[model samples]
Target: MIESKLISKALFSDKSVKSVNNLKDYAGIEYIASMNQTHSDLVTFVKSSAVYDSDGIYTEEPKLGLVVKTADCMPILLSDKKRIGAIHSGWRGLKSNILEKAIKKFDVNELSISIGPHAQSCCYEVKEDVKKYFNDYTELRDGMFFLNMSKVLKDLSEKEGFQVEVSSICTICNSSYNSYRENKTTARQFGVIWK
Candidate 1:
């Protein structure tokens, strides 16, 4: 079993939120806004606290937390102070530019993005075909390819002008978090933020 601690403070990239009972609570957030996460690029602006079928959620509404759940996939929290959003950025979601879609909902401005714990290149092996999707980020070792999922998000965030911070933990390598790729488990950790 993994040591489940209250969200590590040193591990946090921002001060927008904190983990609570495997469920992080964002400051000033009274309600929670999330998506069903279909691994698509679909991003929705939430009107209420209800969860819906989509990959991303954002809002300017105070006291409403924007959250996403992930095991191996990346949970990205975005905040520009004026608006906050969250996305379940699996490989499929990245390939489709879900972050880009999520940013569209907010007006043109700089943003802060944080990538929560997830599977990293050292533990996330992939097929050679995945290379075509990325320019020069994939690596080869003993004829097997390992994908740098974190880099993909960082690069994309840079291109979109969003300042980014990433968690150092790898879900697959560290038992503290769940990884469907490592154990095929359904357990997940939540990444939450608020505006």
Candidate 2:
């Protein structure tokens, strides 16, 4: 009962109210809740309208929509036409395999995935410790290490037996996209999917 869509910048105004309204506009889905987003491997399932009261945990009511906002972090979308999930995956989240964990919670063979715009390694410079977490097979250019998050997620989706499509847009490289690294004070964008 879940479907994925990459919202255009015009829909989200970098404001929570506007973003939430935009989501409502697209699918009549409301903001149930979101997490503090520590970039951990924690994956929560939202199933009720009440879950929106809290942001850090999962719900069980199988509601109509779910959302996650991001600046540089990866917004991982999951759905199978009956249930749906959205996760914020930064380097720390990626290192923890949050996407794998989330997908495992559902019967996702027929699920579809969409990796919303996020900070690419091209614009996401990290310290050595953070850099070391990714496999050495990751691409590098211009003295900065880069990971094709969409590719990684797409591969994972295929492995999980779900159909997948990825957007090549890079948040950091594209001026149209919102990026925490590019503008420290700018607002973030929402990556939303629901059934």
The candidate scoring highest on lDDT is 1
lDDT per model vs. reference: 0.71, 0.60
Residue 89 of model 2, lDDT score:
79
Candidate 1 stretches with Cα past 4 Å from truth are 1-28
Candidate 1 collision pairs:
29-63, 30-63
- Candidate 2 stretches with Cα past 4 Å from truth are 1-17, 50-63
Candidate 2 lDDT by residue in tens digits, 89-195: 77777777777777776667656666766776556666567667766526667666666566667677667678765555677877766777877845777765544
Ten contiguous residues minimizing lDDT sum, candidate 2: 6-15
Estimate, for each residue in 1-195, the C-alpha lDDT of model 1 and write its tens digit: 111132222122222223432343324456777778789888887868887899898887877766687888888877764787788987788789887787777653566677888888888888756767865677888888888888976777667766778877888888777789988987677777754
lDDT computed for candidate 1: 0.71
TM accuracy, model 2: 0.78
Question: After aligning candidate 1 to the native by TM-score, how far in Å is the CA of 109 from where it should be?
Answer: 3.5
| Model 2 residue 120 lDDT score | 67
